[model samples]
Every structure is written in structure tokens, then in C-alpha cells.
Target chain A: MTETTLLTFLQWIDLVGVLFNAVLGAVIGRAARLDVVGLVVLAIMSGLGGGMIRDVMLQSGPPIAITDWRYITAALLGALIVMIVRVEGRLWDRIYPPIDALALGTWAAAGSLKTLEAGFGVLPALMLGTITAVGGGFVRDMVLRRIPGVLGGNTLYATAALAASLVAVGSWYLHVPTIGSIAATAVGAALVLLARWRRLSLPVG
Target chain B: MTETTLLTFLQWIDLVGVLFNAVLGAVIGRAARLDVVGLVVLAIMSGLGGGMIRDVMLQSGPPIAITDWRYITAALLGALIVMIVRVEGRLWDRIYPPIDALALGTWAAAGSLKTLEAGFGVLPALMLGTITAVGGGFVRDMVLRRIPGVLGGNTLYATAALAASLVAVGSWYLHVPTIGSIAATAVGAALVLLARWRRLSLPVG
Candidate 1:
């Protein structure tokens, strides 16, 4: 891709990710029966939440508080999309699991790769990877005054991020080619889906 | 303060801030009836939320993530404090709002002062001031899954930060005495209190 195309692609993906989360957030918020302000808050949390965590973990400082303002714009866009779309019914159910799965893998891959590019080591990269994939969504859920989705004993939320981070670490360790990382991430996400489909959990203390 | 003394004082104050937020977070998490892991997560969210936010807004990159793990240390310390203290009831209750207010004021003043020192204009400076004051708390509430305390129609959170920013900005502009900024900030906070008592609000769209 041309340089502009590359940048545009990344921005578009970011927007897509934000859009996905916004829709999910609104659905959750509606189920929670939150007010307008609450819905908006949840949408922002879902959209920018991971990036915020990634930024913090990367020592990049508050990304959204600065940046193109596009982050917030994307969040607002996502919120609007969800709000207008959800008035009818079931739009969220159509979107949630699959979009969440994609967001999980893509975000983890992006985070680990970006951290590596930023010259961090594998552990830091993985830490950031995990945070990126689940961090925003987690915060979004929590900020909506609910248990954070990732930690709420929900089906395999942070697990996807962890799987992706493992891929990042493994790729770094084996000095595998770039594509290996992506493949590993795909496998990890697929595993998350499997786990979710199986309702896999073991008793814990 | 002497350089060492100042650093120590700042760190001490920062520690106090961390502990304050930790207790507050634990209370909320416990009230929410979360598990230990959940409580830990909430504590982390509350403790570093503002400073991390100010860092992100400054685009300093993941404000707490870069250091050799100081943020983690702070988070743990805060959690430990809360854990040790929470054997009794309502300690967090007695401390929450007032400490939160102090944290907000400190961040707003400190952030605005830093922004002015960095040569930003008044608008950005004011904005930074507000973010610094409330950023962590906002993140805390968000992670706890509630509307941002700063943004929700509760206290005059943003107003206080704005007032401090104006003081910093006015001090920069007027070349006022060294303490003029402090005086202005006090006045601003007082105004916030007045607004709160009167149930005032910024104009809505």
C-alpha cells in the first residue's frame, strides 16, 4: 500500500474496531437500561478503552486526551451507529461475539507488533498486547457501572488477549517470520471461540 | 523545598493520593461484591486513573507504563493499604470525596502549571488542568463501570479543574507574584463549591 494508503488503512481499522465496540457498548448499556449520558460514556469506553490502556502501558502518555481527536470522533460515530441501529432490535446480538472475536485478535496483533516496532522486548510487548485486546472493552464495561466484561467470568474475554500475547511471545522467541505471528493470533482467537462454544471453565478458588 | 525534599514531598503526596484512591476503589469494589482479583483490578483502575490520563493527554505515551514499574508499585501499595485498613468499615467513606477533591485540585494545578511552563496557550492549559485533576478518577469510575465522576452531574469536578487552570494561565499572563496562581486556584475551587451548593451546571447543548 502507498504510505497514505497504509496510514489510512490503519486509521480505518481503528475506526472499525471502535465502531464494533461502540455498538456492543450500546447494546450492553441498553440491557443495563442506562440513560443517554450513560450510553455515551459506555460507547467511549468501549471504543477508546484498549488504546488508552495500550498508550499507558507503552509509556506514550494519554493517547486519546491528545491525538487526532479522531479517537473521540470515532467513539461518537460508533455510539451513533449503535444508538440509531439498536432502536429496532437485536443488532447487538448479530454483532457481539464475532466482532468481539475479530477485535480481540486484531487488537492483540496490532498491539504486540506495534510494541515490538517501538523497540520493546517480548514480555512488555505481550503485556501490552493482552491489554490492548481486552483493556478497552474491559474498561468500557466497567465504566458502564457493570462488572468488567473481561473479569466478570464472561466467556473467554481476556483469554483471547492472552492467547494473542502468547503468539507474540512465541514469535519473538522462535524468531519466526512476521506471518507466523499473525497465524498464531488467528489460532489463538479460534481457540477462544472454541472455548466459548464449549462453555469451558473449571472450578476455581 | 530543597530538591531532595521536594521530590520526597511530591512522592509522599503522590503516595497519599494513591492510597486515597485505593481505599476508595476497594470500597466500591467490595460494595459491588467483586472477588479479590476484581478488587485488585478496581484498585488499580482508581489509583492510577488520573495520572495515566494526564500522561495520555500530554501524549507522553502510556504515562505509567514506561517507567521501571513505578505505577505497579504504587498500585500495589494502594491496594495493600486498603486491604490492611478495610477490616474496619467506612474509612473509605470518610475519606473519598475530600481526598478526591484534593487529588483533583493538585492534578489540575500541577498539570496547568506544567502546560504553561511548556508554553501552551491558555485554552490548552486550562484543558490540561482539568484533565489532570480528574483524569485518574474518571478512569477509576470508568473501570468500575460508571459514568465518569468528573463528567457526570455530581460535583463541580471539571469546574474546579478549570478554575485552577485559569489561575495558572492568569499567573502566566500577568506575571503576577509567585503565589498569585495559588490564590487564583483557591478562588476557583471556592467557586466550584459555590456552584455545587447551588446545583449549578455548565450550559447544555
Candidate 2:
């Protein structure tokens, strides 16, 4: 594929990631029995909070989520769809984790690329990328009065984001082709899924 | 007083505010039974998180908190003092609220001034100012698994910050002299203390 096509595909991946995270946020809001305003707030925060932090850290003008109406619309639409459909029960329980992993990897890769493009060093880029992938969920869980999944005994969620970010940043630093970066993202997402499937967790003292 | 004297005084207010907030954060961390790392993290977040957010939104370069080693040192010192002193019992309980209010007003004023200097409009300046005052506490409370004191019933804390921010931003917008801005900050701080003394609060629905 052309370079333009590769970039477009990556953009699509980011959009999908945003939507998936928004849905997950809405679900958490529902479980918390929050009002509509709370649900919407959670949706937006979970969908874009990390990217907003990244953009601000980079001093990259107004965050894209704040500027682009499409992103806001997408997040709100995800919340609305979940609210209307009420997608709970066994089916959702089975599918949610995998989708969440996909979103995490995609966002991590996207965040690292943005940071790299803005000329930050690799370590900062990797850190920001991991933050971008996990920030929204952290805020959501905090609001719900729970320890953030990343910090607590959840599956290796943040570790997955970090892994994806490292791969993406490594490829960029090596001047690998864009397609190679895309493959790295996939590898990261797969690792998250594998960790989840095997019930892997970081040990706590 | 000379212009240099006035600037130095304002800087002192900011330093005092950071120290007060850091101590409060350390106290909370102690209550939560967090380790030394957690205590220090809470202290830094409570002291500098709001300013970092404000600077980022203003598209300023690296946050002053990150660039200035003095700020970091101040926050760490606050945390260490709390750890060593363990100021609990009646004395701490009585003194803590007033100092916390003082910090809130000072931070609110400082945040408003920075926004005005960055050429933002009055409304954004006011909003960012209020955010800067309360953002640290919000992060701390979130980490501790509780509703943010600003959002929940907490003795009109956020309201006081907003009031202080409004006065400060209004003075700046009116092109008042620096002394006038200083007086405005005083009035804001006085209002917070008055609210606390009178046990005033916004009514919950």
C-alpha cells in the first residue's frame, strides 16, 4: 500500500480505539449507576483523557479531542449506543476484555508516534504513550471509587500499553518502515490478549 | 515597597501554598497506609499537578514544576516533614483546614495571573485558575478511592477557589495595578476563611 494508505489505516485504528474505550467507560458508568451527565463525562474522559494529557505535555496547541467535533461526536455516540442497548450479561462479559486490549494497544502506538513526531526523546515518548493508553480508565475507576486497574491486581493492562509503546518507539528510532510500526502495534495487542488468556498478573508485595 | 519586593512577596505566597498542599497530601497518604513512594507521589501531585495542567493548556513549554528544581524540592520537603513529624491528633486537625484554605486561595490567584499573562480570555483564565487550585487535591482524592472533595460535599472548597479566581482574573482584566491584584487575592483568601468559620456550604440536591 501507499504511504498515504498506511497513514489512513493507522488513523482508522485510532478512531476504533477511541470508540472501544468510550464504550467501556460507558459500561463502567452504568455499573456505577451514575446519572446521564456522569455517564457522558466518563465516556469523554475515558475516550480522550490520555491523548489530551499527551497533547498538553507536547504543547501541541489545543488538544485534537477538544478541537475536532468528530471525536467528541464519536465518544458521545458510543455512550449513547451503550446506554440504549444495555449490552450486559454473558455476551458482553466474554467480548469486552479482548476489545479493551485492542483499544489499549492502538492508543499506545498512536500516542508514541505523536510524541516522536513532536521531537521528544524515546523514553518520554514511551511514557507518554503508556499514559495515553491508560489515563481515561484510570480517571473512570477513580471516579467509581476503585483502585485503577493498572495500579491494582487487574491483568497486565498497563504493561501491555508499555510493551506496545516500546515496540512502536523502537521501530521509529530505527527508521523502520511505517508497515513495520503497524506490525509492532499488532504484536503489542496480541501480547495483552495472551496475558489475559493465561491470567497473568504482576505480583504485589 | 519596591517592584522587586512585591514580586518576591507573591512568589513566597506560591511557595507557601505548595508546601501546605504537599503536607495535606502526605497526611492523606499516611491515612491510606501508603508507602514512602506513594506519600511522595501524592505530595508532588497535590503541589504541582494543577499548575502543570494550566501551563500545558496555555501551550506553555515544559511545566515550571518540572523545570524548576526548587518546586520539586519544596514538595519533597513537605512530604518528608509529614513523614517525620506525624502531626496528628487535635492540633493537626484544627490547623489543617485553615492552611488548606490559604493554599487554595493562593493557588487560585497564581493560576489566574499566569492565564492572563498568556493572553487567554477572562473566562478561560478564571476556569483554569480554579482548576489549578483544586486539581492536585482532586488527583489525590482520586488515588485514595474517594469522590473528589471539590465534587462532593466538602465545605465549599471549589466555590472558594472559583470566587478567588474570579476576583483575580477580574482585576487583571480591568488592568488594575499589581497592588490591586494583591488585594483581590487577600479578599479571596479572607472569604474562604470566613466561609470556614461560619460553616458555610453549597446545598446539595
Candidate 3:
């Protein structure tokens, strides 16, 4: 695919990721017995918070989550769907893992690309990419007064993000960012799925 | 005082706040039995996180924490002091509250003034101001797996920030931001002190 086409694809993935994460956030909020305001807050924060944090840290203009209308619309739609429908049990269990993994991959790729575009080095790109992938969940978990699962005892979520970021950065250095982004997403998502299947976890300190 | 003098004064307060917060963070880390690396991480985050969050959200330039040499130096010095000096017991108990309160006040004032200078309206100023005042402590609490004290059930820390921000914003409207900043700091610090003295707590939902 051409660069423009690849960029468009990444944007679409970012939007889809927002929608999925918003629904998941609402589900968690419901499980926590939160009120409607709390549910909406959680959904929006889980959908948009990571990107916001990344953009803010990049010192870029206002986050695209705020500048673009569609992002919030997608997140709100997700919240509405979760409030109206029962998105649980077997179907949710089967569907959530893959979608979540893909979201993480795409977000990491997008974050790394943006960091590179902003003229940062590889280390910053990798750090920001992982942060963009996991920051929303971190904020969500904090709001609920829980230890962030990615901090320890979970599958290799942060590591997968880091790997995806490294792949993207390497691709950027090789001057093939578009193809690298696609490869990074695939590698990241696959790693997440494999880790889950194998019950892989980093050892606790 | 002149605008230049006021600016200088605020900068000093900002630096002092970082030092105090870094020390506070190190104290907390010690209480948690964290290792040296963890203590340093907590100290830096507690010292600089709030201002960094505010500057990042402002999107005008790089965060002053990263750009300014003194901020990091102050934070590091704070960490070193706590690591070596055994900063607890009667001296800490007597000194901590007032210094902490003053830091909160100054941060809120600085945040609001900067927001207004960034051409944002009153609401953003208030929100960012409160975030600047409490964001570090909030992050510290989250990392420690505790609920942020400002969220609810504690003394009116967030409220004091809001009040200070409101005063600053109001002063900006009156075209006296320099004097307003000083007054806002005083009001915020006083409110915190009063809340503590009276053992006041917010109503929990």
C-alpha cells in the first residue's frame, strides 16, 4: 500500500480501537457498580486517555481525540451499546482478547509513528508507544483504586507493546515506516495472543 | 510587585515545591519499603509530575521540568536529602503540613496563570490549575496502590486548588494577574491549613 493508504488504515484502526476500549471500559464500570456518569467517564477515559496522554507529552497541538469529532462519537457509541446490550459471557470471552490485542498493536504503531514524525529518537518512540498502548488502562485502573495489571503478574502486555514499538522504530530507521507499521501491528497482536494462549507472564520482583 | 519580579517569585516557589514533594515522595517510598530505584522514581514523579502534566497539556512548548535545569536538580536534591537525613518524627510532623500546603497553593496559581496566558478560558484554567496542584500526589498514590486523597474523604485539597484557581482566574479578568497569583496562593494555602486544623473532611457519596 502507498503511504497515504497506510495512514488511512492506521487511522481507521485507531478509531476501531477507541470503540472497542470504550465498550470494555463501560463493561468494567458496570461490573464495578458505578453510576451513569462514572460509566461514561470510564468509557471516555479508557477510549481516549492514552492518545491524549501521548499527544500531550509529544507537545503536539491539541490531541486528535479532541480535534476530531469522530473519536468521541465512536467512544460514546461504544458506551451506549454496552449500556443497552449484554456484552458478556462466551461471545465476549472469545471476541475480547483478539480485539484488545489488535487495539494495543495499532495504538503502539500509531504512537511510535507520531513520535518519529515529531523528530524524537528511538528510545522516546518506544517509551511513548508503550505508554500510548497501556496508559488508558492504567488510568482506568487507578480511578478504580486497583493496581495496574500491566505493572506485574499479568501476561506480557507491556512487553508486546515494547516489541511492537521496537519493530516500528526499526522500520522507520530502515525508511519503510508504512510497511513497518503493518508488520509491527501483526507482530504485536500475534505476540499478545500467543502469550495468552501460553499463559506467559514476567516474573515478579 | 512588577511582573518580572512576580514571575521570578513564582519560579522560586515552583522549585521549592518540587523539592518538598520529592522529599515527601521519598518518605512515602521508605514507608512502603521500596528499594532505592523505586524511591528515586517516586521522588522524581512526586516532585515534577504535576507541573509536567500542566505544561504538556498546555502544548505551547516542552515541559519546563525537562527544559529547566533547576527543576530536576531540586527534585534530585530532595531525594538525596531524604535518603540520607532520616526525615521523620517531630520535625517532619511540624514542618510538612505548611510546606505542602504552600506548594499546592503556588502550583494552582501558576497553573491558572499559565492557562490564561495560553489563551484558554476560565474553566480550562480552573481544571488545569487543580490538576497541577494535585496531579503529582494523585500519581504517587496510584503508584502506591492507594486511592488519591484529594478525590474524596480527605481534607479539601482539590477544593483548595479550585478556590485558588478561581481567585486567579477572577484576578486575570480584573487585569491584575500578578497580584492575583499571590493572593490565590495565600488563599489556597490558608484553606488547606484551616481544613487540617479543623480536621475537616468532604462528604462521601
Candidate 4:
């Protein structure tokens, strides 16, 4: 694909990731029995907080999510949808994990790419990428007064993000095409979903 | 005071504020029964997170705390102190609140001054100032899986910060001597301690 097309595709992925995280945040807010304001706050924070943190750390000026209206709008829409529809029962239970895995992978890839574009070194880029993927959820969990799933004894969340970020960063170093990064993201998401399905977890001390 | 002396005084206040907050953070970590690593992480984050966030938002590169090793060393010392000598009982409790209040006020003043120095408008300065003051405690509470003391119905913690920030920002705008800002911060801390002593709080809805 052309450069413009690739960029557009990447933007779409980023948007999708944001939306998914927003929905997940709203779901958690609902579980916490928070008010509407709380739900919306959590949604927006989860959707954009990580990227904002990363950008700030990168000294990249005001975060793009803040400067651009679309990201906020998307987060608001996702929150509204979740609040209005109230997706529950077995269906949501079955679908939530996969959607979350997809968000994790996409965000990790996008963050790594952005870091690379900023001309940072490999380790910082990879670390920032994982932070971007998990930071939002961490904020959400914190707001709800719970240990973050990534830090707690849960399925491999940060590990998957790290894997996806590594792929994206490695692809850049190897001079792979942009499309290769997307494939790597997909592989990462697949790994997360598979791990969840198999009930796999990293050993704890 | 001369400009050089005034600046030196302000820097000392800033250091004291960071150390106070770091001790409070370590105390909270111990209360949570966290390991030494968790204690140190919480201390550093509480001491530096707010300033880092403010600097990032202002597009100030590499947060001053990260550049100056003193802040990190102070935080480490605070954590180590808490880890080695367990402060408990009613006497420790009585002292903790006042120290925390002092930290809050100084941080609020410092953050507002920094924002003003960055040439931001008054409102952003005030908001960022309050954020910087309360942000470290917020992170600590979140990591411990408890509702943030500021967000929860408490003795006007964030309000005190805002009040201090307003005083600082207003002092700068009125061309009051820099020492006036220190007085304002003292007043802010006094108000918080008074509120706590009186069991005062903002009414919950």
C-alpha cells in the first residue's frame, strides 16, 4: 500500500484501540457503581491517559489526543454507547477479553511507531509502547479502587503489550515495511487471546 | 530579599515539600503492607509524579526531578527510613497530618509558580498547581487500591491546594514580592490542618 494509505490505516487502528479501551473502562465503571460523570471520566482517562503520558515523557508538546478533537469525541461516543446499551450477560463476557486483547496489541504497536518516529532509542521506545498500551487501564483500575489487572495476578496483560511493542520496534530496526508492523500486532493480539483461553499466567513471587 | 536569595529560599521549600511527601508515601506503602520495592516506587512517584506531570504538560523536557538526583535520593531515604524504623501509634498519627498539609501547600505554590514562569495563563496555572499538589497522593491511593483521598469525601485536600495555587498565581499577577507567595502557602497549609482538626469537609451529594 501507498504511504498515505498506510498512515490512514494506522490512524484507524489507533481510533479503534481508543474506542475499545473506552468501552472497557465504562464497563469497569459500571461494575464499580460509579455515577455517570465517573463513568465518562474513567472512559476518557482510559482511552487517552497512556498516550498523553508517553507524549509528555517524549517532550512531544501537548498530546495529540488533547489537540485533536476526534480522539475525545470517539471516547465520548464509546462511553455513551456502553452506558446506553449496557452490554451484559454471557455475550459480553465472551467478547470482552478478545476486544481488550486487540486494543492492547494495537496501542502497543502505535505507541512504538510513534516513539520510533520521534527518533528515540530502542529500549525507551519499547518501554513507552508498553506503557501506552497498559497505562489507560491502569488509571481506570486505580480510579475504581482496585489493583490494576496488569500488576495483579491476572492473565498476561503487560506481557502481551511488551511482546507487541517489541515486534513493532524490531520491525522498524529491521527496516521492515509498515505493513509488517501491523502483522506483528496481530500476532501479539493472537498470543494474548490464546493465553487467556489457555488460562496461562506468568509466575508470581 | 534579593532575587538570588528569594530564589534559593523557594528551592529549599520545594525540596522540603518533596521530602515530606516522600515520607507520607512510604508511610502509606507500609500501611498497605507492600514490599520494599513497592515502598520505594510509591515514595518516588509521590515525591515526583505531580511535578513530572506538570512539566510534561508544559512541554518542559525531562522533568526537573529526573534531572536532579537529589529528589530521587530524598525519596529513597524516606522509603528506607520507613522500611527500617516502623513509625506507629497515636503520636506518629498526630504528626503525619500536619506534615502532609505542609507538603501540599508548598507543592501547590511551587507548581503555580512554575506554570506562571512557563508563561501560561492564570487559570491553567492554578489548575496545574492544584494537580501537582494532589497528584502524588492520588497516585499513591490508586496504587494501594483505595479511593483517592482528594476525590473521596475528605477534609478539602484538593480545595486547600487550589486555594494555595490561587494565592501564588494572584501574588505573581499583582507583582507582590516573592516572599508573599510563601506566606500564602503557609496560610493554605494552616487552613488544611485547621479543617482536619475541626473535622470539616466539603459536603457530599
Candidate 5:
């Protein structure tokens, strides 16, 4: 298939992932008691903040939103859905781990794809993929005046995404087919599950 | 005075301003129920976010901490002082406005100084100054899962910094004396004061 076709396919998947994270962000915002404007702001940040950072690093302007209206639309849809459901009570915290897992994997994939399309080398691609997966949430935490979840040893959270990004880089490097990258993502997800269930961690230096 | 003297003088003032703001950030963090780690994180975010973003936009890496430790030192000192002061209880919300003003003015000055040192043109220099002032807060807001105060309809918060930056830029373009930048910073502060008092706003497009 043409690079364009592959690129377009990747973009579509990223769209889904962004919206999923945005919804989760909105839920978190509501739990925090932020108003509507705050909700949209957080949703947008979750959906696009990392990509924006990545694009800026790559010297691209406007990043996610400038590319298309699709990202914004997806974030809006997800946020609306989350709010309309009016999920209440304390169980919402439990839902976080799962949503986080989904966002990490998909965003890693999107980051790798975009970086490659932008003609970056494998190293930059992998690095950016890690940033894309974790950067948004990290920014979200910092904005809320909290320590970044990744840095604070939240379930080997950043490592899971980093594993996926590295695998994607390796997959592309070896000229492997789509399944190689898929397998890599699965490996990442499996690690997250193991880490969460077992409460695992790498010793802090 | 020599260029080094001027630069050193500016850095000293900038350091003083950032240090106090960092303290303010920590105070707020503690008030918001964050632990030690959270307080440090917020202090750093409030102190360095703008300059870091500016560096990233200009493709500079690691920023202040990556090279000199002055910024970090200031941040730590700020946190330490705040912890010592134990500022809390009533009227905590009132602190935001004043702290915001101080940060805005300081960053505007720093941006202008850095831009002129780099020999950028008037427009970019002014913009860089403004960015230096508010970019950190914007990043902090995004991380905290909220809209940046700058992007919101807040009381011309960023605009005052922008005005200062523009004055610095224009003064340089017109070949004014070094003290012109000081005047520019004052102008920016005055604008912020006017806005806070009169609740001025540029109509949203």
C-alpha cells in the first residue's frame, strides 16, 4: 500500500484514541467540580496537548487542531457523552486504569505514525511516541497543580507506553508487517495489566 | 555598563521575581492539600513552565535546569520560604491575582532580555517576552486539567505581558536606551493593574 494510505489509516485510529482520552479527561474534570469551560479545556488538553508539544518540537505550527476539525469534534463528542452519562459516586476512580491503558496504547501508535510521516528517524519516532502517550496526561496533572502521574510511579504507567513506542520503532525499523507493531502494542498492554495487578515497580534511582 | 553586567543584573532581578512566585506556587499547593512532592512540582511549573515552552518553541533543550541550576535553586528557595511562612487560612484566593501580576512582569522582562541577547527582530522579541511571562502558567493549567488562564477571558492577563514585550521590541527597534525595557515592563504592569481594576477585556473573536 502507498505510504499515504497507511498514513491515513493511522490517522483514523489516532482519532478514536484521542476521543477516548478526552472523555476520560472530562469525567475526571467533572469529578473535580470544574465548570463547562473547564471541562472542554481539560478534554482538549487530554486529546491534543502531547501532539501539540510533539509538533512544536518538530517545528510544526498548531499541531493537532490545525490539521483537521476531527480531533476537536471527537473530544467534544467524548466529553458530551461522559457528561450526559452523569456517572456518579466513587467507582469512577477504578475506571481510570482501564481508560488510561487504552489511551496509552493508541496514542503511542499515533505518535509513531505521525513522527514517521513527518520524516523523522526511528529514535525521534520512538521518543516522540513516548511523549505523545504520556505527555498529555503529564501536562494535565501539572495543570491541576499535582505531580505528574507517570513520574510519581503510577502503575509503571509511562513505561507501558514507552514499551509500545519502542516496539513500534523496532517494528518499523525491521520492515516488519503490520502484525509486528500489533504484537508490540499487545506486549505493552500485557505489561500494564501485570504491573497493575501485581503492583509492580522498578526501583527508583 | 558592559553587556555581561546588564545581563547579570537582569538575571538577578528575574531570579528574585521567579523565586517569590515559586514560593507563592508552593503556598497554594500546600493550601490545595498537596504533599511535598506536589508542592515542588507546582513551584517548578509556576517558575519555569513559560521559559521551558519558549525554549521548546525555539528548539532549545532542557532549558534552564539543563544548563544552569539558578532557576531550580530559586524554585527550591521559594518552596522553602513558603513552607516556613506557613501562609494559609482565609483569603487564599486573593493571592492569585497579585502573584499572577508579579510573574507576568518578571517573565516579560526576561523574555525581552533573552530575545535582545539573541538579536531577534522586534516582533518576535516582544512575542518571546510575552510568551516567557504566561507560557508556564498555561502549561501548568493544561497539566492540571484546566484551560489556561491566558486562553480564557481572564482580566487581560497575557495581554499586559504582550504589551510589555511589544514595548521592549519597539524600544529596541527605535534604538532606545537599555532603561527603555524597564519602562516597558512598567507599562505592562500598569496595563495589568488597569485590567484588574476595571475588568477590561478584548472582545473574543
Candidate 6:
């Protein structure tokens, strides 16, 4: 696919990721027994916080989450979905992992790619990418007065994002950013799934 | 003062706020028995987080914290001070309230003024201003797995910031933003000090 086509595809994935994360955030809010305002706040924060942070750091203009209407709409729709439907039990358990993994992978890929395009260095790209993948959940956890799971959990979420970022950055250097984005997403999703399946936890100091 | 002079003065106060908050953050880290890295992280987050959030939301240039060397330097200097001195006891107690009050006032004034200058509406200015005043401590508290003191407790921090923001915005409308900035700062500082002195706490819903 051409670069523009690749960007368009990624944009769609980004919206999907936003929707899924927003739903998850609202679900968390439900679990916490928050009011409607709290639920919506958590949904928006979880859906858009990471990308907003990345865009702000990149200094590349306003975050698309704010500039584009669709991002917020998607997030709100996710909140609406959770508010109306009782998404729980065995069916939710069956779908949650893949949805979360896809969100992580797509978000990481998009973040790293955007960083590279904005003329940032490899270190920043990696940092921003990992932040983009995990930042929403981190902020959500914090707002709930919980220690961010990403900081100390045995989960490989952050590590997987880092690896995906490396792959994307490597692809950029090879002059095949399009392929790199696709490959990075796949690698990130695969790794997260593998980690979850094996209960792979990083050793803590 | 002329507009430029007013800006320069606020810039100085802004740095002072960064220094004070960074020290406070490190103090909290020390209280938590955090390592050096944790201290530094908390210091930077508390020092710069609020303004960064405001600037990013404004969608203006890069955060002054990142573009200006003095901001980071001031924050690090705060960490250095905390690491070198055991800043607890009667002397620290006598000093902390005034220092914290000053930081909150200056930050709210700066944030509100900047928001108006950016051509945003009054509500955004107020919201951003409050975030500027209280966001650092909120983030720090979250990182420490504690509920933000601003959200509960009888403290009038957020309310004081709102008043400061209102003053600043009011001044802008009168074409006296310089006076507005100064007045806003004074109002914010005084309110915070009064709250602390009276042990005033807002009622939680």
C-alpha cells in the first residue's frame, strides 16, 4: 500500500483502539461504582490520554483526539455501549484479551510512526510509543487511586510496546515504513497474546 | 508594569513555583522512602506537570518546560536541595504553607493569563488555570497511590485557583491583564493561606 493508504488504515485502527479502550475504561468505572460523570471521564481519559500525550510531546500541533471529531465520538460511543449493555461474564472474558492486544499494538505502531515522521530521535520514538500504548491505562489507574499496573506488574505490556517500537523504528531505517507499521502491529499483538497465554511476567528488582 | 515586564515577572514566579513544588515532591518521595530515581521523577512531575498539561491542551508551541532550560534546571535544583537537606521540622513547617500558597497563586495567574492570550474562552481558561495550579500535586498523589488531596479534604486549592482564574480573566476583559495577573496571584495566595490558617475544607458531596 502507498504511504497515504497506510496512514488511512492506521487512522481507522486508531479509532478502533480508542473505542475499545474507552469501553474498557467505562467497564472499569462500572466496577468501581463511579457516577456517570466519572465513567465518561474515565472513558475519555483511557481512550485518548496516551495519544494526546504523544502529540503534545511531539509539539506537532493539537492532538488529533481533540482536533478530529471522530475520536471523541468513538470514545463516547464506547461509553454508551457499556452504559447500555451488560458486557460481562464468559463472553467478555473470551474477547477482552484480543481487543486489548489489538489496541496496544495499533497504538504503539501509530505513535512510533508519528514520532519518526515528526523528526524525533529513536529514543523519543521508543519512549513515546511505549507511552502511547500504556499511558491511558496508567492515567486511568492513577485517577482511581491505584498504582499504575504498568509500573510494577509482571505483565509485559510496556516491554511489548518497546519491542514493537523497535520494530517500527527499524523498519523506518530500512526505508519501508509501511511494511514496518504492519509488521510492528502484528509483532506487538502476537507478543502480548503470547505473554498472556504463558502468564509471562517480567522479573522485578 | 508594561506587558513585557509583567510577563518577565510572572516567568520568574513560574520558575520559583517549579522549584518549590519540585522540592515538595522530593520531600514526599523521601517520606515514602523512595530511591534517588523515584525522588527525581516525582520532583520533575510535580514541578512541571501542571504547566505541561496546560500548554499541551492549548495546542500552542512546545511546552516552555521543554523549550526553556531554566525550568528543568530549577526542578533538578529542587531535587538537589531535598537530597542534601533534611527539610523537616518546625522551620520547614513554618515555611511550607507560605511556599505552597505562593506556588499555587503564581501558577494559576500564569495559566489563566496565557490561556486568554491564546484566544481561548473563559471556561477553558478557568479549567486550564485550575489544572495548572493543582495538577502536579494530583499526579504526584496518584503516583504514590494516594487520593489527591485536592479532590477531598477541606482544602480550597481548586476553588482558590478558580477565583484567581476569574480575576485574571476579568482583568483581561478590562484591558488590564498586567494588573489582573498581579491581582489574581495575590487573591489566590491569600485564599490558600486563609484556608490553611482556618483549617478550611470544602464539603465533599
Which residue pairs does candidate 5 place in steric collision? A139-B143, A140-B143, A141-B143, A143-B140, A143-B143, A143-B144, A144-B144, B49-B136, B50-B136
Query: Model 4: residues >4 Å from true position, as ranges?
Result: A1-51, A64-138, A146-205, B84-86
Q: How would the docking of model 1 be graded?
A: incorrect
Q: What is the interface RMSD of each candidate, in Å?
A: 4.3, 4.9, 5.2, 5.0, 8.3, 5.1
lDDT of 4 at B132: 87
> Model 2 over residues A88-116: C-alpha lDDT tens digits?
88988887777777778878888888888
Candidate 3 lDDT at B155 equals: 77
Q: Give a tens-digit lDDT track for model 3, residues A10-122.
A: 88988999999999999999999998788889999899998988888778677889999999998898899898999899999998899889889989998988988887767
Provide the TM-score for each candidate, comma-separated: 0.60, 0.62, 0.64, 0.60, 0.54, 0.61
Looking at model 6, the pairs that clash are: B154-B201
True contacts kept of each: 0.24, 0.23, 0.18, 0.26, 0.09, 0.24
In order of listing, the candidates' clash counts read 27, 0, 0, 0, 9, 1
User: Which candidate has the highest lDDT of all?
Assistant: 3
By descending lDDT, how would the candidates be arranged? 3, 6, 4, 2, 5, 1
**Model 5 compared with the native: what TM-score?**
0.54
lDDT of 2 at A11: 73
Clashing pairs in 2: none
Q: Is candidate 1 or candidate 2 better by DockQ?
A: 2
* Model 3 whole-model lDDT (C-alpha atoms): 0.86
Per-residue lDDT tens digits for candidate 4, residues A1-205, read: 7877886887787887788788877777777665554466577788988888888778766676655667877787778978789677898788777777777888888888889989899899889999998999887777876778889567787888899998898888887738656865786788789888898888885
Tens digits of per-residue lDDT, candidate 1, A165-198, equal 7776676567752554556457556866776889
Ten contiguous residues with the weakest lDDT in model 1 chain B: B60-69
User: How far off is residue B115 in model 3, in Å?
Assistant: 9.9
Complex DockQ, candidate 3: 0.15
Find the 10 residues in a row with the least total lDDT in model 6 chain A.
Answer: A146-155
- Tens-digit per-residue lDDT, B1-205, candidate 4: 7877887886776777787788778888888888889989999988888887787777866688889998888888888878887766798788777777877888888888887887666766776787788888877877777767665356777788888998888888888738656876787798889889898775331
lDDT values for all models: 0.65, 0.78, 0.86, 0.79, 0.70, 0.85
Query: For model 3, what is the alpha-carbon lDDT of residue B109?
Result: 93
DockQ of 4: 0.16
Model 3 clash pairs are none
